[model samples]
Target: MKKILVVGLFLIFACGSESKAQAPDAVKKTFQAKYPGENDPDWHQDDHGYFEAHFKIDGIKYRADFNADGSWVETETSIKKKDLPKAIKDVIKDKYGSEDISEIEKVDSASKGVFYDVEFKQKGKNKDVEFKADGTIIG
Candidate 1:
């Protein structure tokens, strides 16, 4: 009787570990299809227990949020080369006089007005500058 109980307990523990080790295959498949070209993206559980895909496309990174059951909720893409505003370009060139500003992005905030965010590396220290649509520094 003791041996039988031990075997049963072992089986239960093993099954639990297996379940924890495996994510829902259906969820992974759906996520891959939804976020077409994301390479080796990481899936993280959000507050609502949904999975989010953090991936890059066309050299621009993005975060695709999906529901717990594998349904897509929303996607946020970082500022891409083709999406930068002209006002931001002038400001970055002038402010960071000697630095090479690699990328500039115009981020549309839901609450605040549109802003220009610039990314540059100065003396090996990465810096991000946020400016208003009119080229005024906001951050």
Candidate 2:
């Protein structure tokens, strides 16, 4: 009984630590260099193996993603519907005027450049749509 209890406890602790793994030193340094003076970032590993740092700047929440080798992948911040670009707003008004926007995020990425992620609830399910600055749908 004692042996079994100890093994169970050990497994629990090991699994917990794995889930709470810290970001690599290189990633931390890169983050500091990019956003100096901003501290207290909560780090997590995303599904794509990227290190994501959740923090706020000037009271605006931001999530910055960095590669394990310290390369910046992207940074995103939530924005209001009214804050969207005029072209995007027009497109949404024309196509999805009836549907309410659930959330909006402005993403700046290294590969795909800058884009907006707009989410809407359709048929009791959430759907995300990506758009470029010119209101062209990318995905």
Candidate 3:
């Protein structure tokens, strides 16, 4: 009985300690303000020392990054190909009709407007395309 109690206490402490290892209070507050109901999210420090939150809403997965000062940097979310704009789909089909789309992510940043990053595979080549919300290609 004593061993079981000790194990239980250790497990609780370990779980709680993991949350304490998350980003700073400022970052958490910023994330909370940005995504009000998304209280529980996976967090990690990026290469640039920013905090990244991985969460899901309405069945869509998203990642929001906050800088050290708690400023929102950017956000990315996966999108379905069928949901893409008609012009964007037309362009992709015209350019790489033979390729298979592997992934499509919509990214919004403070420095740039909303855009989609599409990753596709063609034969033996892998490529990525960027498209603005207006369905215009941007490199």
Tens digit per residue, CA lDDT, model 2, 47-92: 7888999999989999999999999999999999989999999999
* Candidate 2: segments with Cα more than 4 A from true spot: 1-19
Best by TM-score: 2
Off by over 4 Å in 1: 1-42, 45-61, 64-76, 80-82
Q: Report the C-alpha displacement of residue 69, candidate 2, in angstroms.
A: 1.3
TM-score of each: 0.44, 0.82, 0.76
Residue-level lDDT tens digits of model 1 in 69-107:
666666655666445566665776677767766666555
Winner on TM-score between 2 and 3 is 2
If both were scored by lDDT, which would come out higher, candidate 2 or candidate 3?
A: 2
Candidates in order have lDDT scores of 0.65, 0.90, 0.85
Q: What's the lDDT for residue 50 in model 1?
A: 59
Clashes (candidate 3) = 0
